[model samples]
Target: MPDLQRTRDPERWDEEEPPTLTTDVTIEQPKTIITRNQSPDIAFDRSINAYRGCEHGCIYCFARPTHAYHGLSPGLDFETRLFAKPTAAALLRQELDRRGYTPAPIAMGTNTDPYQPIERQYRITRGILELLLETRHPATITTKNHLVTRDADLLSAMAALGLMVVNVSVTTLDRRWRAPWSRGPRRRASGWRRSACWPSAAYRSTSSSRRSSPHQRP
Candidate 1:
Protein backbone atom coordinates (compact mmCIF):
# COMPACT_ATOMS: atom_id res chain seq x y z
CA MET A 1 0.00 0.00 0.00
CA PRO A 2 1.18 3.56 -0.74
CA ASP A 3 2.11 5.56 2.33
CA LEU A 4 -0.46 8.36 2.35
CA GLN A 5 0.94 9.76 5.61
CA ARG A 6 4.26 10.67 3.93
CA THR A 7 2.48 12.00 0.81
CA ARG A 8 0.51 14.54 2.81
CA ASP A 9 3.40 15.41 5.10
CA PRO A 10 6.14 16.97 2.95
CA GLU A 11 8.42 17.23 6.03
CA ARG A 12 8.54 13.44 6.24
CA TRP A 13 10.25 12.85 2.91
CA ASP A 14 11.40 16.14 1.43
CA GLU A 15 14.92 15.83 0.17
CA GLU A 16 17.13 18.88 0.29
CA GLU A 17 20.62 19.13 -1.21
CA PRO A 18 23.43 19.61 1.22
CA PRO A 19 24.86 23.10 1.41
CA THR A 20 28.22 23.78 -0.20
CA LEU A 21 31.12 24.28 2.14
CA THR A 22 32.67 27.73 2.41
CA THR A 23 35.70 28.99 4.26
CA ASP A 24 35.03 31.00 7.39
CA VAL A 25 37.46 32.69 9.75
CA THR A 26 37.24 33.62 13.38
CA ILE A 27 39.86 36.09 14.62
CA GLU A 28 41.48 34.90 17.81
CA GLN A 29 43.39 37.27 20.07
CA PRO A 30 45.82 34.92 21.69
CA LYS A 31 47.35 36.28 24.88
CA THR A 32 50.56 34.39 24.28
CA ILE A 33 52.08 33.10 21.08
CA ILE A 34 54.87 30.85 22.28
CA THR A 35 53.73 27.32 23.08
CA ARG A 36 56.29 25.33 25.07
CA ASN A 37 56.73 21.60 24.65
CA GLN A 38 58.37 19.35 27.18
CA SER A 39 58.66 16.20 25.05
CA PRO A 40 62.30 15.15 24.90
CA ASP A 41 61.94 14.10 21.30
CA ILE A 42 60.73 17.58 20.28
CA ALA A 43 63.67 19.51 18.88
CA PHE A 44 62.31 22.95 19.78
CA ASP A 45 60.72 23.75 23.12
CA ARG A 46 58.90 26.79 21.80
CA SER A 47 56.65 27.03 18.77
CA ILE A 48 53.80 29.05 17.25
CA ASN A 49 50.84 28.40 14.94
CA ALA A 50 49.50 31.39 13.05
CA TYR A 51 46.21 29.72 12.22
CA ARG A 52 44.09 26.85 13.42
CA GLY A 53 42.32 24.51 10.91
CA CYS A 54 44.11 24.06 7.62
CA GLU A 55 42.50 24.58 4.22
CA HIS A 56 44.31 21.48 3.06
CA GLY A 57 41.73 18.96 4.16
CA CYS A 58 43.92 15.93 4.61
CA ILE A 59 41.43 13.32 5.91
CA TYR A 60 44.16 11.67 7.93
CA CYS A 61 45.25 14.86 9.65
CA PHE A 62 45.96 13.98 13.25
CA ALA A 63 45.04 17.45 14.42
CA ARG A 64 41.52 17.21 12.96
CA PRO A 65 40.18 16.12 16.35
CA THR A 66 41.19 19.47 17.80
CA HIS A 67 38.29 21.20 16.01
CA ALA A 68 35.84 19.39 18.28
CA TYR A 69 36.72 21.82 21.07
CA HIS A 70 34.98 24.54 19.07
CA GLY A 71 31.71 22.55 18.97
CA LEU A 72 32.31 21.80 15.33
CA SER A 73 32.62 18.58 13.37
CA PRO A 74 36.19 17.45 13.11
CA GLY A 75 35.74 16.37 9.50
CA LEU A 76 34.50 19.14 7.18
CA ASP A 77 34.43 21.80 9.89
CA PHE A 78 38.13 21.38 10.51
CA GLU A 79 38.90 22.51 6.97
CA THR A 80 36.07 24.95 6.21
CA ARG A 81 36.04 26.87 9.47
CA LEU A 82 39.35 28.32 10.68
CA PHE A 83 40.75 30.57 13.37
CA ALA A 84 43.56 33.06 12.91
CA LYS A 85 45.86 34.56 15.49
CA PRO A 86 46.25 38.01 14.04
CA THR A 87 48.17 39.35 17.04
CA ALA A 88 50.74 36.58 16.96
CA ALA A 89 53.66 38.85 16.17
CA ALA A 90 52.80 41.39 18.82
CA LEU A 91 52.30 38.73 21.47
CA LEU A 92 55.54 37.01 20.51
CA ARG A 93 57.52 40.23 20.86
CA GLN A 94 55.88 40.92 24.20
CA GLU A 95 56.82 37.51 25.48
CA LEU A 96 60.37 37.86 24.21
CA ASP A 97 60.65 41.20 25.96
CA ARG A 98 60.00 39.66 29.35
CA ARG A 99 62.89 39.56 31.77
CA GLY A 100 64.88 36.30 31.95
CA TYR A 101 63.56 35.31 28.53
CA THR A 102 66.24 33.24 26.76
CA PRO A 103 66.54 33.10 23.00
CA ALA A 104 66.05 29.72 21.35
CA PRO A 105 65.15 28.84 17.81
CA ILE A 106 61.37 29.28 17.61
CA ALA A 107 59.55 26.73 15.47
CA MET A 108 56.64 27.58 13.17
CA GLY A 109 54.09 25.17 11.71
CA THR A 110 54.47 22.73 14.54
CA ASN A 111 50.74 22.26 15.11
CA THR A 112 49.35 23.84 11.93
CA ASP A 113 50.79 25.23 8.73
CA PRO A 114 51.76 28.83 9.39
CA TYR A 115 52.16 29.49 5.68
CA GLN A 116 48.57 28.49 4.89
CA PRO A 117 46.83 30.34 2.07
CA ILE A 118 45.31 32.93 4.44
CA GLU A 119 48.88 33.95 5.22
CA ARG A 120 48.83 35.91 2.00
CA GLN A 121 46.31 38.37 3.43
CA TYR A 122 47.13 38.30 7.14
CA ARG A 123 50.95 38.35 6.79
CA ILE A 124 51.13 37.45 10.48
CA THR A 125 53.70 34.76 9.75
CA ARG A 126 55.86 37.20 7.83
CA GLY A 127 55.58 39.75 10.64
CA ILE A 128 56.71 37.19 13.18
CA LEU A 129 59.71 36.25 11.02
CA GLU A 130 60.55 39.92 10.53
CA LEU A 131 60.60 40.44 14.27
CA LEU A 132 62.83 37.38 14.66
CA LEU A 133 65.21 38.80 12.08
CA GLU A 134 65.35 42.23 13.75
CA THR A 135 66.17 40.72 17.14
CA ARG A 136 68.54 38.14 15.64
CA HIS A 137 66.36 35.41 17.06
CA PRO A 138 66.68 32.03 15.44
CA ALA A 139 63.65 30.19 14.07
CA THR A 140 62.67 27.08 12.13
CA ILE A 141 59.77 26.65 9.69
CA THR A 142 58.13 23.68 8.01
CA THR A 143 55.45 24.03 5.36
CA LYS A 144 53.80 22.37 2.37
CA ASN A 145 53.41 25.63 0.45
CA HIS A 146 56.00 27.03 -1.94
CA LEU A 147 54.65 30.48 -1.03
CA VAL A 148 57.35 30.43 1.63
CA THR A 149 59.60 31.57 -1.20
CA ARG A 150 58.01 35.03 -0.98
CA ASP A 151 60.15 35.57 2.11
CA ALA A 152 63.30 34.21 0.45
CA ASP A 153 65.15 37.51 0.79
CA LEU A 154 64.68 37.69 4.55
CA LEU A 155 65.24 33.97 5.04
CA SER A 156 68.46 34.00 3.03
CA ALA A 157 69.99 36.62 5.30
CA MET A 158 69.02 34.64 8.38
CA ALA A 159 70.24 31.37 6.90
CA ALA A 160 73.57 33.02 6.17
CA LEU A 161 73.92 33.68 9.88
CA GLY A 162 72.90 30.16 10.94
CA LEU A 163 69.69 31.57 12.39
CA MET A 164 67.04 29.84 10.26
CA VAL A 165 65.94 26.62 8.61
CA VAL A 166 62.99 25.72 6.38
CA ASN A 167 61.63 22.29 5.68
CA VAL A 168 59.01 21.44 3.05
CA SER A 169 57.03 18.36 3.91
CA VAL A 170 55.37 16.49 1.05
CA THR A 171 53.11 13.65 2.12
CA THR A 172 52.49 12.00 -1.28
CA LEU A 173 54.30 12.80 -4.51
CA ASP A 174 51.44 11.46 -6.64
CA ARG A 175 49.07 14.25 -7.74
CA ARG A 176 46.00 12.00 -8.06
CA TRP A 177 46.33 10.61 -4.57
CA ARG A 178 46.26 14.06 -2.93
CA ALA A 179 43.32 15.60 -4.81
CA PRO A 180 40.53 14.31 -2.59
CA TRP A 181 42.10 15.47 0.68
CA SER A 182 44.07 18.47 -0.55
CA ARG A 183 42.64 21.78 -1.72
CA GLY A 184 44.90 21.94 -4.79
CA PRO A 185 47.87 20.27 -6.42
CA ARG A 186 50.55 19.72 -3.85
CA ARG A 187 53.67 21.83 -4.38
CA ARG A 188 56.38 19.96 -6.27
CA ALA A 189 59.32 18.63 -4.27
CA SER A 190 61.63 19.89 -7.01
CA GLY A 191 60.76 23.54 -6.29
CA TRP A 192 61.26 23.01 -2.60
CA ARG A 193 64.69 21.55 -3.39
CA ARG A 194 65.64 24.68 -5.27
CA SER A 195 64.40 26.81 -2.38
CA ALA A 196 66.41 24.80 0.09
CA CYS A 197 69.60 24.82 -1.99
CA TRP A 198 69.43 28.44 -3.13
CA PRO A 199 68.83 30.03 0.27
CA SER A 200 71.04 27.45 1.94
CA ALA A 201 67.96 26.56 3.97
CA ALA A 202 68.23 23.46 6.11
CA TYR A 203 65.20 22.03 4.35
CA ARG A 204 64.50 18.33 3.96
CA SER A 205 61.81 16.45 2.05
CA THR A 206 60.20 14.36 4.76
CA SER A 207 57.42 11.93 3.86
CA SER A 208 54.58 11.95 6.36
CA SER A 209 53.73 8.31 5.67
CA ARG A 210 57.15 7.21 6.88
CA ARG A 211 56.85 8.55 10.45
CA SER A 212 54.77 7.21 13.30
CA SER A 213 52.66 9.63 15.30
CA PRO A 214 54.55 11.08 18.23
CA HIS A 215 51.68 10.16 20.56
CA GLN A 216 51.60 6.60 19.29
CA ARG A 217 55.36 6.00 18.87
CA PRO A 218 57.15 3.97 21.53
Candidate 2:
Protein backbone atom coordinates (compact mmCIF):
# COMPACT_ATOMS: atom_id res chain seq x y z
CA MET A 1 0.00 0.00 0.00
CA PRO A 2 2.85 2.38 0.68
CA ASP A 3 4.58 2.19 -2.70
CA LEU A 4 1.49 2.26 -4.88
CA GLN A 5 1.08 5.49 -6.81
CA ARG A 6 -2.30 7.21 -6.77
CA THR A 7 -2.87 9.66 -9.60
CA ARG A 8 -5.71 11.28 -11.42
CA ASP A 9 -3.54 11.53 -14.54
CA PRO A 10 -4.22 8.33 -16.48
CA GLU A 11 -1.21 8.84 -18.77
CA ARG A 12 1.21 8.59 -15.85
CA TRP A 13 0.25 4.93 -15.42
CA ASP A 14 1.71 4.01 -18.80
CA GLU A 15 5.16 5.20 -17.77
CA GLU A 16 5.34 2.88 -14.77
CA GLU A 17 7.63 -0.08 -15.11
CA PRO A 18 5.82 -3.33 -15.62
CA PRO A 19 6.70 -6.37 -13.55
CA THR A 20 9.37 -8.44 -15.23
CA LEU A 21 8.13 -11.23 -17.49
CA THR A 22 9.96 -13.74 -15.33
CA THR A 23 12.18 -13.14 -12.35
CA ASP A 24 14.21 -15.08 -9.84
CA VAL A 25 14.73 -11.95 -7.78
CA THR A 26 12.46 -9.38 -6.15
CA ILE A 27 13.26 -7.06 -3.27
CA GLU A 28 10.53 -5.38 -1.25
CA GLN A 29 10.97 -3.61 2.06
CA PRO A 30 7.69 -4.18 3.85
CA LYS A 31 6.86 -1.82 6.70
CA THR A 32 6.00 -4.63 9.09
CA ILE A 33 6.57 -8.37 9.63
CA ILE A 34 4.59 -9.66 12.65
CA THR A 35 0.98 -10.08 11.57
CA ARG A 36 -1.60 -10.25 14.38
CA ASN A 37 -3.86 -13.29 14.36
CA GLN A 38 -7.49 -13.91 15.38
CA SER A 39 -7.82 -17.56 14.47
CA PRO A 40 -9.28 -19.74 17.24
CA ASP A 41 -7.24 -22.83 16.52
CA ILE A 42 -3.87 -21.14 16.12
CA ALA A 43 -1.48 -20.91 19.04
CA PHE A 44 0.41 -17.69 18.28
CA ASP A 45 -0.31 -13.95 17.99
CA ARG A 46 2.31 -13.03 15.36
CA SER A 47 3.90 -14.57 12.24
CA ILE A 48 6.53 -13.67 9.64
CA ASN A 49 6.39 -14.53 5.95
CA ALA A 50 9.64 -14.11 3.99
CA TYR A 51 8.21 -14.45 0.50
CA ARG A 52 4.99 -13.51 -1.21
CA GLY A 53 4.56 -16.32 -3.75
CA CYS A 54 5.77 -19.87 -3.87
CA GLU A 55 7.57 -21.48 -6.83
CA HIS A 56 6.80 -25.02 -5.70
CA GLY A 57 4.05 -25.06 -8.35
CA CYS A 58 1.87 -27.45 -6.41
CA ILE A 59 -1.64 -27.18 -7.87
CA TYR A 60 -3.43 -27.63 -4.56
CA CYS A 61 -1.68 -24.70 -2.94
CA PHE A 62 -4.20 -22.72 -0.92
CA ALA A 63 -2.08 -19.56 -0.89
CA ARG A 64 -2.39 -19.26 -4.68
CA PRO A 65 -5.37 -16.92 -4.38
CA THR A 66 -3.19 -14.13 -2.97
CA HIS A 67 -1.47 -13.41 -6.33
CA ALA A 68 -4.51 -11.52 -7.64
CA TYR A 69 -3.71 -8.48 -5.47
CA HIS A 70 -0.36 -8.12 -7.29
CA GLY A 71 -2.13 -8.25 -10.69
CA LEU A 72 -0.40 -11.54 -11.39
CA SER A 73 -1.91 -14.70 -12.81
CA PRO A 74 -2.22 -17.12 -9.94
CA GLY A 75 -1.73 -20.06 -12.31
CA LEU A 76 1.73 -19.81 -13.89
CA ASP A 77 2.94 -16.60 -12.34
CA PHE A 78 2.60 -17.99 -8.85
CA GLU A 79 5.17 -20.59 -9.82
CA THR A 80 7.62 -18.92 -12.22
CA ARG A 81 7.20 -15.57 -10.45
CA LEU A 82 7.93 -14.58 -6.81
CA PHE A 83 8.46 -11.70 -4.39
CA ALA A 84 11.08 -11.29 -1.66
CA LYS A 85 11.26 -9.23 1.50
CA PRO A 86 14.96 -8.45 1.79
CA THR A 87 14.38 -6.14 4.75
CA ALA A 88 12.19 -8.51 6.76
CA ALA A 89 15.02 -9.61 9.00
CA ALA A 90 15.86 -6.07 10.02
CA LEU A 91 12.20 -5.13 10.44
CA LEU A 92 11.57 -8.12 12.67
CA ARG A 93 14.44 -7.30 14.95
CA GLN A 94 13.27 -3.72 15.27
CA GLU A 95 9.74 -4.86 16.12
CA LEU A 96 11.06 -7.26 18.73
CA ASP A 97 13.01 -4.40 20.27
CA ARG A 98 10.01 -2.10 20.70
CA ARG A 99 9.80 -0.38 24.09
CA GLY A 100 6.86 -2.40 25.44
CA TYR A 101 7.63 -5.56 23.44
CA THR A 102 6.57 -8.71 25.20
CA PRO A 103 8.25 -11.90 24.10
CA ALA A 104 5.67 -14.44 22.97
CA PRO A 105 6.33 -17.28 20.54
CA ILE A 106 6.38 -16.13 16.90
CA ALA A 107 5.37 -18.49 14.16
CA MET A 108 6.91 -18.79 10.69
CA GLY A 109 5.80 -20.65 7.58
CA THR A 110 2.17 -20.09 8.55
CA ASN A 111 0.97 -18.35 5.39
CA THR A 112 3.94 -19.11 3.11
CA ASP A 113 6.74 -21.63 3.35
CA PRO A 114 9.89 -19.84 4.55
CA TYR A 115 12.21 -22.39 2.99
CA GLN A 116 10.52 -22.31 -0.40
CA PRO A 117 13.20 -22.65 -3.12
CA ILE A 118 14.03 -18.97 -3.74
CA GLU A 119 15.09 -18.86 -0.10
CA ARG A 120 18.28 -20.67 -1.14
CA GLN A 121 19.50 -17.53 -2.89
CA TYR A 122 17.73 -14.71 -1.03
CA ARG A 123 18.36 -16.11 2.46
CA ILE A 124 15.95 -13.63 3.99
CA THR A 125 14.28 -16.26 6.10
CA ARG A 126 17.65 -17.58 7.21
CA GLY A 127 18.60 -14.12 8.36
CA ILE A 128 15.37 -13.90 10.32
CA LEU A 129 15.95 -17.20 12.11
CA GLU A 130 19.41 -16.12 13.06
CA LEU A 131 17.98 -13.01 14.70
CA LEU A 132 15.39 -15.03 16.59
CA LEU A 133 18.07 -17.43 17.79
CA GLU A 134 20.23 -14.61 19.03
CA THR A 135 17.32 -13.00 20.87
CA ARG A 136 16.31 -16.30 22.49
CA HIS A 137 12.77 -15.75 21.24
CA PRO A 138 10.50 -18.79 21.17
CA ALA A 139 9.16 -19.77 17.75
CA THR A 140 7.38 -22.51 15.84
CA ILE A 141 7.60 -23.45 12.16
CA THR A 142 5.69 -25.67 9.78
CA THR A 143 7.21 -26.45 6.42
CA LYS A 144 7.21 -29.28 3.90
CA ASN A 145 10.74 -28.75 2.57
CA HIS A 146 13.96 -30.31 3.83
CA LEU A 147 15.77 -26.98 3.50
CA VAL A 148 15.00 -26.49 7.17
CA THR A 149 17.59 -29.14 7.75
CA ARG A 150 20.23 -26.64 6.72
CA ASP A 151 19.37 -24.67 9.87
CA ALA A 152 19.28 -27.70 12.09
CA ASP A 153 22.10 -26.28 14.13
CA LEU A 154 20.02 -23.24 15.09
CA LEU A 155 16.88 -25.31 15.61
CA SER A 156 18.70 -27.85 17.75
CA ALA A 157 20.15 -25.09 19.86
CA MET A 158 16.77 -23.42 20.24
CA ALA A 159 15.18 -26.74 21.14
CA ALA A 160 17.74 -27.25 23.85
CA LEU A 161 16.64 -23.92 25.32
CA GLY A 162 12.89 -24.72 24.88
CA LEU A 163 12.50 -21.89 22.36
CA MET A 164 11.62 -23.62 19.10
CA VAL A 165 9.58 -26.39 17.51
CA VAL A 166 9.01 -27.65 13.98
CA ASN A 167 6.14 -29.50 12.39
CA VAL A 168 6.61 -30.95 8.90
CA SER A 169 3.56 -31.40 6.73
CA VAL A 170 3.35 -34.42 4.43
CA THR A 171 0.08 -34.14 2.51
CA THR A 172 -0.23 -37.75 1.59
CA LEU A 173 1.62 -41.03 1.95
CA ASP A 174 -0.02 -42.73 -1.06
CA ARG A 175 2.24 -43.86 -3.88
CA ARG A 176 -0.23 -43.68 -6.80
CA TRP A 177 -2.02 -40.51 -5.74
CA ARG A 178 1.22 -38.82 -4.74
CA ALA A 179 2.87 -39.88 -8.01
CA PRO A 180 0.38 -38.05 -10.27
CA TRP A 181 0.59 -34.88 -8.16
CA SER A 182 4.38 -35.02 -8.06
CA ARG A 183 5.18 -35.63 -11.76
CA GLY A 184 3.92 -32.29 -13.08
CA PRO A 185 6.64 -30.45 -11.13
CA ARG A 186 9.57 -32.76 -11.88
CA ARG A 187 10.13 -31.91 -15.57
CA ARG A 188 10.23 -28.17 -15.01
CA ALA A 189 12.22 -28.14 -11.75
CA SER A 190 15.24 -30.18 -10.81
CA GLY A 191 16.11 -31.40 -7.27
CA TRP A 192 12.46 -31.93 -6.28
CA ARG A 193 11.70 -35.39 -7.57
CA ARG A 194 13.44 -37.16 -4.76
CA SER A 195 11.47 -35.34 -2.05
CA ALA A 196 8.08 -35.86 -3.71
CA CYS A 197 5.47 -37.28 -1.32
CA TRP A 198 5.80 -40.87 -2.47
CA PRO A 199 7.76 -42.97 -0.03
CA SER A 200 11.48 -42.99 -0.59
CA ALA A 201 12.54 -46.09 -2.53
CA ALA A 202 14.40 -47.14 0.57
CA TYR A 203 11.15 -47.15 2.53
CA ARG A 204 9.28 -48.89 -0.28
CA SER A 205 12.03 -51.46 -0.60
CA THR A 206 11.92 -52.30 3.09
CA SER A 207 8.19 -52.59 3.70
CA SER A 208 4.90 -53.73 2.25
CA SER A 209 2.48 -51.14 0.83
CA ARG A 210 0.13 -49.39 3.29
CA ARG A 211 -1.30 -46.67 1.04
CA SER A 212 -5.06 -46.17 0.78
CA SER A 213 -7.05 -43.19 -0.46
CA PRO A 214 -10.10 -42.11 1.51
CA HIS A 215 -13.58 -41.80 0.02
CA GLN A 216 -14.71 -38.28 -0.87
CA ARG A 217 -17.54 -36.53 0.92
CA PRO A 218 -20.78 -36.94 -1.06
Best by lDDT: 1
Tens digits of per-residue lDDT for model 2 on 52-148?
8775566667888898898988877777678899999899989999999999988888767888767888888789889998999988876666676
Q: Which segments of model 2 are wrong by more than 4 Å?
A: 1-23, 174-176, 179-218
Count of residue pairs whose backbone atoms collide, per candidate? 0, 0
Local distance difference test, per candidate?
Answer: 0.75, 0.68
- List where candidate 1 sits over 4 angstroms from the true fold: 1-21, 179-186, 197-218
Error of 2 at 95 (Å): 0.3
Screening candidate 1 with a backbone cut-off below 3 angstroms (N, C-alpha, C), the clashing residue pairs are: none
Per-prediction TM-score to the true structure, in the order listed? 0.78, 0.69
Top candidate, metric TM-score: 1
